[model samples]
Target: MHINPYGEDPVRFAVELAVDPPSSAADLVARCRAAGVTDVTGREVDLDDVRRFLDEWLGVVDAPDEAARADRLNALLAAASAYPRLTNHAGDGWHLHYRDPDLPLAGVLRALISVGTALHLAGRGMHRLGRCAVAECRRPFADVSRTGRQRYCSPACANRDAVRRHRARVS
Candidate 1:
């Protein structure tokens, strides 16, 4: 009976999907399920809907300032969110859901991502999300590091950039 709040996991999932988008509807569902978004099952999900949501969600990821990010997230929240409710369906434990009870997969993802992003930025820091600092690898990332100073999408990118800087210094 673990509670899965729409926080870090959903934000990381959003970053993963944004950085390396799924190739198909099935792939999207599979990735969501793999991420423990179990409610995605038993719902109608269309590739186009997911793509549209991701396209709009990228607006939030790429926003240049906190205000812009808030604005973009507000749009998503407005479109997707509803009143919070509690349920214990299938003995999954009592938890809050920020969407309607019967939302489809795409709707669930939209609400999850919007609310999750808001919660993450609010609970963490507004600047906790961004693109990788490496010029050639501007993939999106959620900076959940201890210092919240993550600049690269992953350690590989960080190491690559570090080595590149060292070569530049020697040259």
Candidate 2:
């Protein structure tokens, strides 16, 4: 079965890109492929534009409250607005795409990231996306945990914080 592309994957990808942005167009394309994005072609990619778009997206992640987050995300959604359409590009089977056909890799990523983030937040919870609880490593992360109480970006960060707390108690 064809999985929905505009779902958890894109949101997770956004987090990955935000944490360590691609250094070049080739790097971006390679990372996209690594993240299961098969549609990217060797078209001229503008890394600056993608970085700018990602900065805007990070605003939603860093918003002070739910309302602010929604507002920021709504702006991005509006910017990437396109009527949903079905296609079987690359013989991947029919799937819904919320973007215009033949768009550049940057355009496609903007739409996917925006729509995917919306779906993730609406389907999961507004508080699902956040920064790591570790003060030294405030990296962004998409909390896909079943219990939805994830505070750190990774198990290591969580364990590090816990160990610090334990040491403090002992001292």
RMSD of each: 1.2, 0.9
Kindly report which residue pairs in candidate 2 clash with one another.
none
Total colliding residue pairs, candidate 2: 0
lDDT of 1 by residue, 63-133 (tens): 98999999999999999999998877657578888899888888999999899999999999999998889
The true-versus-predicted C-alpha distance at residue 46 of model 2, in Å, is 0.6
lDDT of 2 at 110: 93
Clashing pairs in 1: none
lDDT of 2 by residue, 1-171 (tens): 788888699999999999999999999999999998888875568899899999999999999999999999999999885999988987958888999888888888999999999999999999999999999999999999999899999999999999999999999
TM agreement with the true structure for every prediction: 0.95, 0.97
Give the TM-score (vs. native) of candidate 1: 0.95
Off by over 4 Å in 1: none
**Alpha-carbon runs more than 4 Å astray in model 2:** none
Top-scoring candidate (lDDT): 2
